[model samples]
Target: MSTPTGFMQYQRELPADRDPIERIKDWNEFHKHLSDEQLRTQGARCMDCGTPYCHTGMELAGSASGCPVNNLIPEWNNLIYRGLWREALDRLHKTNNFPEFTGRVCPAPCEGSCTVGLIGDPVTIKTIEHAIIERGFEEGWVVAQPPKVRTGKKVAVVGSGPAGLAAAAQLNKAGHKVTVYERADRLGGLLTYGIPTMKLEKNVVDRRVNLMREEGIEFVTNTEIGKDISRDELLKEFDAVIMCGGATKAREVEIEGRELNGIHLAMDYLNGTIKSYLDSNLEDGNYISAKDKDVIVIGGGDTGTDCVATALRHGCKSVTQFGTVGKAPLERDIINNPWPQFPNVYTLDYAQEEAKALYGEDPRAFSVLTKKFVGDANGNLKELHTVQIERTVDPETGRRIYKDIPGTEKVWPADLVFIAVGFEGPEKTLIDSFGLEQDRRTNVKAAYGKYKTNVDKVFAAGDMRRGQSLVVWAINEGREAAREVDKYLMGSSMLP
Candidate 1:
């Protein structure tokens, strides 16, 4: 593998980030890259276990525990440790099409399963990944390569999110004519609008979108498949169709006064804010402005953290996040989460740090459940009532039990309330139109290896098929689904 002696001697190192107080003033990425030497040293910390579970990509405890894309983690780590930047990048891109995206946002399950992490800190797998991709981009190694010959077959991708983009890119590389349709005016569905610019810069996404366009992939915007164009029209116009529509429907809290004007869905607020920022610097009201408002977000997930950060940028008076789950232990809790699995220990993300810097304390309230929203006479939300909940595991049933404790009710003043619980599934219109079955989780029903639906010549992938998930998972699904579609279209195919 890599230099064996170097690995046992060096220590792991992670990239440093900007100060939270300064970072919240503007919408920019807070992460700072490690130097080339630092990155190589970090890679040298990989022990390169004989049984590398980091890239296994297998189901553990009924859920994926390692890299879902089955990235060649050990191979890349070795390459990086040897200072072979190009080779490491080549191996990384073999499975993942967009390492830049995942490097910044992916939770990095590969590190969680790293054998080196069983006893100490995991090898800096995420750091080496970022360095390799960033180097590729800087050295002009990444360029659009259109297929040499045309297959004369056409495919239509129904969304412009990560999954749709991945499938379209792969299908086009296989010499098939591909077109991506997006309901939004811009491409990069959630990446362009749903996510804030601070986490992932729009220019980064736009650069890739431009490259795809150069590769002769057609992108149609403001086109709703069912509403603007009929489903039959798509079936007739294309040889095959791939549905990558993301799960847009947000999970909402149905409580008293939820209909208040100031109350909004997390996606709505986030999407609006990003879109507005894109249009003439927010002058057109393209995004929801949280300026000068007392925002009380009702959820402690990534979405809620994003809301808190966005409100701080808008100069909000105050912000708080209500979470139903108990706070995680400060240190690794191997008894429950276990080693070689994702650690559920408490960590400070960018938004949480910014909130702490501004308010002098983190705004998270663990085990607090929102009971109801209180609205003013103008139909605007003014406050939120919440109660502390005790969570217990049932011994016999093996299920989680929650009980509201007495005398723990509290109220917080809130002008803007965002429900950031999560997402349910993709929209029902297209699934119903295709007569496709849905899983118990409301995702499009199809066997893991079999992407075919009830109808002929129809396939699904990403959030539409697997429900709300990480972007890396969407990329994996898209690649697998493209292989299935290519096989269906040409009997035998040559796509990797």
Candidate 2:
């Protein structure tokens, strides 16, 4: 620890974000940075726990219990606390290939499992992490370091999302010639398109990609495997292949009036908006407009929250989100949700905070189920029919069920609807072309930590194999898959 009583001396604090209402007016990033002194104080809060669970990176109760990247949190925390910034950045980069991405987007599981959190608030690990990386960039310490020698082995990574990028970076570092294939015009598959611009600016992603390009990795855009490029061509060109294609197939909600004109998938809506915003600053009348519309976003996840924020930015009259489950408790239920499991407590995320600022209330309706969408004579969505629901358990099968409450049905006005109910699995196009086996959930059949598929010299990782997951988990899978690929290519591997 920086100091024995640092945790007790300094209470947890975070830099204030831009006012939500003011920030929604523009698409630029709204987060502000803390000064070096404040960040150092925050770093000092790391406790000297002999057994640090912050970086254990274990899964518990179907959620991540700690940092999935297994970041050396305490080490960097101590380094930053003692005013050793370059050293802190080095310690951070030793594990996470892209701290800039994770620091901005990751819902930090490291904070939940912090030993200090058991007593009081956890150290601002994420903030400190963000600070360290930004400092590295400002001081010009983050630069491309090309491999000293080439292994003469060539590897191909499909998709350019978190997993694909991490895998490509690692494989290149191991002296292998790496080529990444992205179907989209731009790189960073989900990172470039799925996430909104305000949350993760495109410049940050481009900065990293540009650096990677300088390190001798080849990136091919607008080229897809199995379609634009044949399966035989890939097998003939590379010694091994790693599928990092993310789970892009968005899940649909089957209900009445499904063919309404205004009903759209969340990813499509988000993807178009971002593309248009980047292309022509929304001047080109190419994307869907939410102006003067009453929007009802279906499904209450991060995507739904983002829909709400996007609508508000478009000058929508009103926006509301529907959730199938009941509201989470204000605090964790100690008996059910113990420490180390990501705390199931209630907190306002960035997008929700923006929604609440404009609407004067939380925009989410919990335990509400949409029965059908109502449309006009022109087949345009106008409203949605819904009913209140109650939770119950079946004694015989021990299965949880949702029971609708009587006399609680209502109609909500909705000029536009976005289905943000998550994803099923990776797209089957490339998977089928390779003739790879799939799990019952439609994910590529690859054992965790091993990443080897049934097909020879072909492996899978990230959302392609793990289904829909966090970016940090995708990074973990990508890094691990690179190690496995290295071992398979050579007699043994030294990759971590």
Candidate 3:
């Protein structure tokens, strides 16, 4: 249970980040690491609550309240506090297939729901998680344990993102001949190209992919399903197919000047930069440069934050982010978003912090809506027409609606505009070709946990199944789908 009184003795602490000005000069990860001793103290801060809501994995107020992967949080915290590093890694791997990925990019919902957070602060769960997995890698504890007996059954996993990777790893562990097909040239889907190197380094992803390869899982890249290879060929070649193709259908802003030259989707911009950076350190000029331009990013979310950071790194002259809703409260409101639920509080993300440091002001403009893009004679976007909005809750339905404030119209100069509004669902070509049913959101129709599609021997999980979601949720869905696939193939299975 960790040290019983440890929570009282030590306060929560996190690894100090590098100065934003210096860190933004390059596209490398900015956060520094905590030493082993400090990490142990942070782990010791776990309160060992009777409920242990940190690992509950339940829905509260329409959002996940705890670790979506149902990570054995308390067990690992106790292990780390007890100085059993390897044991903590084992416990971490029991539920989550890729702690390194989650440790780096995940928002750490578990910390938000921590019992310690009820009053003072939450244990540094995410940092401790990062330390544990990195320690395992450093000590040569993490290795390939190929299955001894092959089931002789073959499985094909579509996509190479978190969900697809998780399913492939679990299925391979169950002795099924597994082949992961990624549409992208790289094995790690969004992890490889969609996210910037500063947030999640490509080598970190490659390290795990290489380990998976060593464990006998075959990976085929630049292979698009239903295009390069027909869906029928996949069904015919494999005993089972798990579709983890993420929700790549981006939600676009359909405005008058959307066709302007400087406007681009968030994924395209991010992926292009990474691709160019990787190929020749940006000498290829394949990416849309934000240099010396007034950048305006629409949609204030993680993707938007990433865009802001990327633009800053490209030496953008200025940057601004538009938030459709009003700014969140400075602190969690007990009357509304109570404890144990994911807090709806205003927090400065890395990108926002960097922007504030660079520009001497927060880049975000809340309660604002972009009406249309104004373009120059050359059809290049020049300005964004926007208006302030006030949120009003309907008395009958209790639904929140936005009302435009008259005479509050304004325009912002913008040389480059990025749409980071979010995703709708998976692309239609693959799902349509398979003749699979989809939910109203256009996500593949697969019941949670069951993961079975209407078509026999086919399953769906992750963003493809549940629209846009967190990486941790994708890992959970993928692991659960793998178990269901194993059961379908072998009648009964040992996968957890």
Question: Over all chains combined, what TM-score does candidate 3 have?
Answer: 0.98
Tens-digit lDDT track of model 1 for 378-466: 88888889999999888999999998999999988888888899999989988877777899988888667667877778889999998
Better of 1 and 3 by lDDT: 3
Please give me the total number of clashing residue pairs in predicted model 1.
4
Summing lDDT over every window of 10 consecutive residues in candidate 2, give the lowest-scoring window: 39-48
TM for candidate 1 is: 0.96
What is the alpha-carbon lDDT for the whole of candidate 1?
0.85
Q: Residue by residue across 270-335, what tens digits does model 3's lDDT show?
A: 999999988888998999999999999999989999999999999999999999988899999999
Alpha-carbon RMSD of each model: 1.6, 0.8, 1.1
Tens-digit per-residue lDDT, 282-383, candidate 2: 899678889999998998988888888888888999889999999999987879999988899888888788888988888889999999998999999989
TM-score top scorer:
2
lDDT of each: 0.85, 0.92, 0.93
Which model is ahead, 1 or 2, in terms of TM-score?
A: 2
Which lDDT value does model 1 have at 332? 74
